[model samples]
Target chain A: MEKKIYKPTDIDIERLSALARISLSDTEKESFSCDIATMATYVSSLLSDVSAEHEREARSLDELREDTPVECDCARDILALSPSLKEDHVAVPLVVGKDKEGDA
Target chain B: MNELIFRSLDEHKRALTAREYSSEELTRAYLERIEEKEPSINSFVSLCQDRAIDAAKESDERRRNGAPLSALDGIPYAAKDNIAVAGLPLRCGSRILEGYISPFDATVISRLKSSGCVLLGKTNLDEFAMGTDTETSANGRTKNPLDENRVTGGSSGGSAAAVAAYEAPFTLGSDTGGSVRQPAAFCGIVGLRPTYSALSRYGLVGFSPSLDTIGILSRSASECADIMNATVGADSRDATSRPFPASDLRALIGKDVRGMRIGVVREAIGEGLSEEVLEAMQVATDTLRSLGAKMTEISLPHLHAAYAVYYAFSSAEAASNLSRFDGVRYGYRAESCGSIEELYERSRAEGFGDEVKRRVLFGNFALSGENREKIYGRAVAMRKQIIAELSSVLSRCDLLLLPTASTHAYRAGVKKSALYCKDDLLCTLAALAGLPALSLPYHRDGKLPVGIQLMGPAFSEDRLFSVAHLLESALDRRESAK
Candidate 1:
């Protein structure tokens, strides 16, 4: 099997930052690209060296928690902390169309 | 009052009980010290003067009524900024959560409060508890109390520094990788990362859920034990917490380790270790031997990969956990954003420091598509292997002894890449295994301090305390003789 190698590019940084929803400046992009590439290379080596003989079964979910309803004592307080709120509802920007569709 | 600020928690308790000093006086002394030293150390992000004094007054009333709480009653301590304290700002040393107040106290805080322990305030940490040096904190960098030009090792640097500088008798520091233990070493104090789930993490801001642990930093092993006794228990709020047999940890201290089998991790001392750290390890081993504790060299062959594994898992978890700060419900919200996406991007971009952004980006990459199997999956497997290896080795020994860090605390702003991972290399092994580890100040090279670390199997905190107490006394005697 061919050993995987990672060399992060500017495109990779842009894609990842988009996924993480974090904007980055050009300087941050260049620097983080290098750091990510270095770390990826290191993790690749660790993956390749992992012994396959010690593979164990996944944990059983027998202890899965039951669905139980509990009241949150600070529910009102939590909502009050929102950046924008309307009638006790946490108000967010419309996800679908732009301003025209939502307002109309 | 000046001397009162430097005394141990137990001593403060004794003095408080004897009416030699009031809890109000003790609290005021610490507050004054914090006021004086905080400018130089930058340890506290917030000072709870009004709250602390009120709590101290209440504690004095309780003491007067002959109803003292736990051993730590009337004693003041600080919490890392990540731990939630009711009505206090939970900035987490980041600009994102600035001015965000916690509505409720964390389970540990409530436990401490119920025991009459007064809160001094929240100390600084690496932003989101992501970095080893507290330098990454968005609030500001914490300077080592011992040397102003040097860094107080982080992400609990401020907490460790507060205790070391006598601003607080002890403090709570959360350990994900080496957050607590590393800073404790750097600040010349004692820090313990208890077994994962030994202490409740219900109120701690999440970093890496699997590895994040609430730990204690103090002037002595006994004090750490005392605090642990008060805080350690099962909590319904945190499902990961489990019930353990109740034991008095303070009673375990001062007991001799006559037949304790200590394992010296051979790989920990090889290459990358400094001469002073190596000498300190040697003296630690000899001191343990002199105290009649047996020592044997043990190896964890896969230990070298600890940093890689730790970063992979912790970064991935951090990415998921921090996504909650999306400029929506709470935290910093960017103004003049055209869309929700822009809101998130702008807020996080402005809020997170470089180190945090770097890790978050790496996390996203690690968990995406094929990289999930190649990176995250394999790292998980490696973690299991490492845990198994540690468990096997620990089966033969009572504890594993090693240096907490490869070298003494470095000067502030030493931007060498090699120094970044060095803090976690020696300490991550125990963290990965979910075992308890303690870093105790061992040797001081001129002004800087070196700490020796000990790792014990799960729930072996009592035994670790006993061994550490004996070793601390032995080292003290040797120092006094010189």
Candidate 2:
């Protein structure tokens, strides 16, 4: 299989930051694009060189705790830590366009 | 009694018990040292002076009533900012979480508290514990106690420097990929990354869940063992934590290593290792050999791929973990945003440092498209191979010996590059395999100390500490003779 070469551009970084939900300044986009491109090339080389025969198994869930309900008083404390709280719940800026004032 | 700040945890405990010095006095001395050294070393992010003094007073009262909490009663220690301490700001060395106070104590902190260990404060780390040097911390870079110009290896640099500067007798640091051990090595102290799951990760801010471990840094291996003895146990809150049986780690310190076999990773000492560090490893191996331990060169062929594997796995996990820092619930929020997306984008953009942003972007890129299978999948496969190879090599010997880092701590503001990855390469092998590893300061190249790393099979901290204690004693004797 032919490997796809990675050459990150400012557009790619912009899209990636969007996907990551992180806004990048114009200066940051230029520099991060280069750094990501360099890292991508390095990772590509490393991936292409290594054999892919061995697959490591993740930890088994057999030892996981039983789903027993337990009361915790941490909710009040967690709400207190919120940047913006409406009553007992965390509040955030309107997500749906319909909820915005400018939207009809 | 001011010198009590430099004494071992055991010595401090004895002094407290013998009434030679009050816990209040001991805590005061450490607090004073922190005040004096903090400007030069830049270790602590928040100093819990009032709380520590109150705790010290409580400890004094307990001892006076003949009801001391534990062997570590009244001993002052610091925790890396990532570890949650109730009422203490858990900034995690990042602007993103600045002023975020923890509502609950981490399992390790609670355990330490139950034992009456006085918490001096929280130490700085790489922002979100992502970088090798503490320079990435938004709080400011932590300098090496020995040389202010040099970096304290990070992201546990502050914890290491705090101990090295005698600001605290011991401090807790978390290691994902050599964070604890590397900084410990750089600062010339004992740092142990216990077997994964040996210590609870419930309260440590996640970096790479599978690889993150709460570790201890102290002036002596025995103190690390003491802290380990008190802290290592299962927590139902953390599914990854196992039921680790309590062992008298201190009792194992002076045990004989007459027939113990140590494997020296041939790959570790190659190419990137500095001459001074390599020379230190040679002397350390020789010292261990003279102490009746046998040494053999062993190969873990997949070892060289550790940095790539670690980056692929850790970055992916870090991206996921850091995703929680949206503007809504907690932490730094962007001042003004019309939409949720902008809120998240602007908050993260403004809050996260450059290195963190780069990694998160890299993670997104790697996880998208065919790159996921080509990079992430192959990395997963290589991780298994690395683990298998290390297991096989470890089966032949009691422990693996290597350099904690490729070189001594670099100058502050050294650019992050591929070359810097070499610092984490040696330590990543043990981390990847979920085995216990320790960095013990063995030699000094000028003012900087070189650390020799010892890694052992899973849950083999007892034997690892035994070998390290012996090596530490021999090195001390040699230094005293000189």
Candidate 3:
């Protein structure tokens, strides 16, 4: 298989920054140039072998599970683990910005 | 007889079912032994007295009522601390999770409990399951039970040590590369890493989601097989959990391997293999040949790149899996952090051990935005090639037999040459291939034990176990005569 060449444009950096969940300074970005491009090239290779031809559309991660009975005990555990649970619902701080897509 | 502790797990189960021993009596004896021998070995991070006694009482009650859960219902088992057991501290041998408790039991633990197995407690492991030696554990290094100055092979060192110390009959461990089998070999026990996806990964604190599998350590291959049979199946909660057709497999002991082809991977048996280890492999094959198994040599071209591939993928997975430890919701968050960032860095920096931080840094470097392709990406591709090469070779062979690890257990923190230091990777090919592999105790060179690794096609665990059982019997007979 011929390798794909990738250039890390500003948008690619933005995506990677979100993926890594670490803020990058300008010098950090400059240092990361070759690495970002390299990783993108590799990801594209794995994507090539995925054979998306079998599926008409890719479903979201949460939608991947089949319709099945949800165990009450499991749900209880989730609620018990949540820090800000109020009447069986988890409370979370309002986000400063929306999350990047396709991160999962 | 303490001989029961050394017997095959299957035999003990059968004997227990035949009214030979009550579950209560067995649990009591093991508990007493753990109390006596566990201090020096440091095999367990936590001991589940209440849970074990409760289960034992219930088991005795069931027996008195003329009903039994299963032959293994009352069997006591230990779990590596990396695996979660509800209400028990799931400390991954790191200070970060020192006081952390799991909200739910790991799938394997839950399955064993459902089958009436008693939870002995959580065994020790390397911190966050990062190091090859268990010495990096925050809870102190687990000393080899056989030779205290020598180390128990790790990061599943405690799981192996527990079985060796007879603190528990069997234990569950995770095998990413050779964590389970390497330690088992050192501890002179049987460790089975079932084919990838055989058991669910849910509730396991140890990361490396793609490569990690729940493995079993037992005194005998049949005992390992029994646990595998109970734990291997599909779980809707686990996205990668695959079904293993276990019911149809016969537990063949001393079965003939007439016309069966066995390949010894040249890459797996390389330079620096100890004289004892090399001799053990030769003797094992000679015995297998006498049992009618044909042997040949096979080469995996990508085997040289297999370790690199494993580190890349395993670390990348590690980087992602460990991101949850920000001290936000639970676990050991920083106590005196001035701010959120301080809390995050200090909690991790202070809580994690030196080896863990080093690997995480390395993993972060590989998985970082700039270098992901050169390291993690190349490694993934290499992983595929290794698996493909392994698959193609398996079409011509019924099994592959080789050394489990290049050499026997080393003394604590004794570093070998660069080539020899990393020789553990030689035996991890079957792990990377996602094939079912068995490490059976073959011989002990008076320093520590060496294991004979038997690898078979993916999902061919029963057949692999059958061969291992035969070999184990032959070795055991020889040992007894000696």
Weakest ten-residue segment in model 3 chain B by summed lDDT: B415-424
Clashing pairs in 3: A35-B370, A36-B370, A39-B373, B73-B116
lDDT of 1 by residue, B189-270 (tens): 8999999988999989977999999999999898899999889999999999976565788886776777889999998886
RMSD per model, one decimal: 5.9, 6.3, 8.0
Ranking by TM-score: 1, 2, 3
What i-RMS does each candidate reach, in Å? 5.9, 6.2, 9.9
Q: Write the per-residue lDDT of candidate 3 for residues B353-438, one digit (tens) a residue.
A: 65554345446766666456545655555666677688888998888887887777788877411122356666568778778888
- Fnat per model, in the order shown: 0.62, 0.61, 0.00
Q: What 10-residue stretch in candidate 3 chain A is worst by lDDT?
A: A53-62
CA lDDT, candidate 1, residue B24: 95
* Candidate number that wins on lDDT, 1 or 3: 1
Instruction: Let me know the DockQ for model 2.
Output: 0.30
Better of 1 and 2 by TM-score: 1
The best candidate in terms of lDDT: 1
For model 2, name the residue pairs that clash: none
- Using DockQ as the yardstick, the better of models 1 and 2 is 1
Q: Score the docking of each candidate (DockQ).
A: 0.32, 0.30, 0.06
DockQ of 3: 0.06
Would you give me the overall lDDT of model 3?
0.74
> For model 1 chain B, where is the 10-residue window of minimal lDDT?
B473-482
